[model samples]
Target: MDYDVVIVGASIGGCTAAILYGRAGLRVALLEKHRNIGTAKRLCGHFLLGRAQAPLQRLGLWDDMVATGAGTGDLSIRTEYGWTDRSRVDAPPFLNVRRTTLDPILRGRAAASGVDLLLGRTVTGQLTEGRRVTGVRARLLDGTEETHTGRLVVGADGYRSKVASLAGVPERFTPNGRAFFYTYYRNVRHTLPTPAVVWWNDRDWVVLGPTDGGLTEVAVMPAKDTLPPDLTDHAAYIERYVASLPDAPDLTRAERAAKVVIAPDYPLIRRHPVPAPGLALIGDAALTADPTPAPGCTWALLSGQWLADATAPALLAGDDPAAALRRYRRAHRAIEREHAFMRGDAEAGPPSAVQRLLREAAVHDPEVSRRLALVGMQVAPTTSLLNPALAARALLVRHRSRRRSAGRAGHAPAV
Candidate 1:
């Protein structure tokens, strides 16, 4: 093989994997479709939550990211009942930065760390030897073709990954009820208690946060029917959105930094754990939950690190990578458990009884609120919501609140 690893995509996930692979003394080739080094994802929430800390630190990017002027703060979410108090959350704070600045930093790190960065290269087909994937065939920007072979070919090209499609990866998609829109604003006031705030309701999920360059990104996920026919009038749309939610920041004085950008129509995607022999998939290429919460960025960084950790030793020892692939599959399934719940949430229309109860209880129960925030930040497993002790505490709080309401109603003056 010409290389030990050939990775498709050079975004955060791909760059992260390349950085790790190079660190492990492995020869790696990182391919990217875009030739521009400064290109950034325009339609993103860009909030790197608590879950992303581990991988960022392990990749030696914690301080570097902080140095990039990425805002650091905790997350506060509001449900219909009230704000899910994050005062009790002890996890590490999140980093908020735009992809414009973040992407180049990761890509630069990958190049400096000795990974072969192949830009303006598009993978058109996969190379298979017998029953296993061996490499990829690609088209160069200069109207030339090239074949890159590797012991392991990783498809990190994201949601509609050509590599996965070429490898015949099995995937499923669930329809989403929300239409997404995002834009940036200058002079936007920072929400209290930190860099970001999320408003979650059955009808909408809105996230607002400060990114680099003193601008704020507001991503809205309202019911498909709720959006107007013309989204070009961003101010009007944001005004209407603020009017609908409680305690939302007033963007009246904030100036629009650019035109509104509508997110691509995307359903919840889940691809098979192991796509093919000697081929691996990570980040959105493997699975994607509801985009309403903007969970893709966190998972992208994490899945890359997980793949590197699982397969590095095998590649170094000249052993079969299948066992390592199985380990990665297991790690992938662990996150799939969390994504499963998110998928159910996106398709289930509104919050069910349990979800409502949990959100309601979170308003008054600190522990419950903390756990809820952790899960929302993708730091905790969805199973944490099922803790018997925590559930019982939330249940008790709900019962008392109900009794108080009943007592007050009985004593109401004649009206």
Candidate 2:
């Protein structure tokens, strides 16, 4: 094999995987289609939540990321009812950095850690041996084709991954029902409880946050079929809708930093069994859920770390890659199951009678609000969100509230 591991794509997930393997002294080939290092994908929001902090700290890049002058602020979520308003919450919150700035930093760090950076290279196909992937075939910048073999090949190529299709890994599709248009702006006093701002306008949503270089990143997600025709005049569109919404003026007429970028076609899918005989997929390639749950850079980093842990022993032993691949698949599925639970709950909504009662209680009760936050954040298991004890408490609260209302109406409580 030319390399111990060949990673397709050189963005956050691919580069992070390379960094971990390279640190393990594995010969790694990191391939990127784009010529430039740190080339940013326009559509991403670049929000890194608190959970992903531990992995960066482990990789020794946490301080470096902070030094990069990424946007620092409070993280808050707004529903039609109101913002979760957690700026007062005591915790080291999320960071919003531009992909262009942060990706290059991560890629550079990976190369410095001894991963071969194959920039300006397009991977065209894989070398398979009857159900086992052996390596990849790629085209170089000068149009030269090369075949690189590796014990393990990682398809961190993202949502539209050719590797997943070519390797015969089937992905489970989830209709996003929506798409997004985003751009950067300046001179917006968009302060929040944390660096990230997530606004849920019923089913539609919008987010605005600071990225690298003090530019505020703005994105509006609407149902795919309902997008406005003229994105060139995005500000005018935003102004008409956001002006009346509470705390949304920051998004209406902010100074423009760049032209609007529209992603009216990114569908969400969750790929199952993220590994094969010699290949493993990570990041968006592994499992993609709705952005409403805020799975972005943080999830990518976390998944990359998972790939590293799963394959480290195999790389060390220089043995058949199947062992590593199996472990990788199992670990990836475990993480996916965790996210799957959240995704399922999101799709179902609070539909059951118990859930409806709890939601109504949460609207007025502080304790219920905390529990709601836990479920929304995926901090608690899906089952925990519907715990019998919690449900009983909610039912009790609902009963009390109804009795009080009836008393105010000068009528006996209805049976």
Candidate 3:
């Protein structure tokens, strides 16, 4: 084999995997279709929550990320009823950094780790032998075609991964029923207790968070049917939408620092069979939940680490890499299945009755609020909020509040 692993993308997941494989003394080929590996992804929210910290630390990038103006803060969510603030005492603070700053750092680290980084190369097709994927046929920027053979191939190219398509990975997609648009604003004041604030009003949702270089990322997700036809005037549309939101920051006071970014027409949830024979998939190639929750970067980093950990020993020892890949597939499914289910449900429509009850209960109950936030941040399982103890507490709180309201009505003067 010309290389041990041929990774299809140069983004966070692929770079992390490449770095790990290179550090283990395995030859790695990292390919990127883009000329500049550090180019910022337009549609990303770029908010890395608590769960991403451990992986960043393991990659020796925690302090560097912090130094790049990333700050730790809590999460605040506001619904039509009211607001709920959640701050976890035990978890690390969330890190908000733009992909422009974050991606380059990862790519640099991957190159320094001795991986062969190939830029401006498009993988046209895969090289397969019988039932197994062996490598890829790539076309260079100059229109030159080359076949690079490797022991294993990894598809980390993202939601519309060519590798996954060519390798015949089974995929399932669920529509989110919304479209997202975001842009950066400079000199915007941060008013929330948490660095991140999410507001849900009717069929509309907005998220605001601080990112590197003193810019605030403002993202809006509205029902697809509500989108205006003239999206070419992005600034006008975003400003008008923000102005309509109750208690939203005045965009007139802040300078628009970047072009408005829009998500391409694609489903919010995509699930694929993760591994087959000598082929493995990670990051968006394997599964993608709703981006409305801002879980993409965190999941990418985590999935990459998980795959590398599973396959490193096998590659180093000349053992069957297929066995390790299978283990990775199982572990990935086990960890992400429930999360994917919850995200799919969320994308389909408004909160369910139970979800609404929990959110309402969270307003008056700190523990409930914390658990909800943890689950949203992917630090805890969705079952945490569904536990008997928590459910009982929520019901009791509702019962008490109802009784108090009834008593007040009984003693009150006629309106």
Arrange candidates by lDDT, descending. Answer: 1, 3, 2
Give Cα-based local distance difference scores for all models: 0.83, 0.72, 0.80
Candidate 2, lDDT over the whole model: 0.72
- The order by descending TM-score is 1, 3, 2
Give lDDT tens digits, candidate 2, residues 1-415. Answer: 3999999988878988899999998999999999898687766767676666678788888888778887765556665545553423443456677777788888899889999999888999899888788899999889899988988888888888888988878777765666666778888875455456666665567777777787877777665555566556765665555565577754545678887776656556777544567788888887776664566566678788888888888788977856666776776665576676645534433345555565566544556656665544444445676688887777777677778889999888875
| Model 3 steric clash pairs | none
**Least well predicted 10-residue stretch by lDDT in candidate 1:** 406-415
Off by over 4 Å in 3: 85-90, 228-234, 244-246, 269-273, 346-348, 402-415
Model 3 lDDT, residue 362, Cα:
73
The candidate scoring highest on lDDT is: 1
Candidate 1 residue-wise lDDT, 56-170, digit = tens: 8988888888887777777787899988766687766788888888888889889988999998998998889987999998899998989999999999998888998998888
Tens digits of per-residue lDDT, candidate 3, 1-415, equal: 3888899999988998998899889999999888886775666778887888899898889899989997457768776656763543344568888888988898999999999998888999999889888899999888988887788889989988899889777787777777778898998864666677878766677888888898888888887777877567767787888888766788879999999888745575455545568888888888776776777788888888989999989988877797888778777875576656645564546677777777777766778778877877778877777798998898776666556667888863322
Q: Alpha-carbon error at 66 in model 1, in Å?
A: 2.3
TM-score of each: 0.94, 0.86, 0.92
lDDT of 1 at 51: 86
Question: Local error of candidate 2 at 309, Å?
Answer: 0.5
Best of the candidates, TM-score: 1
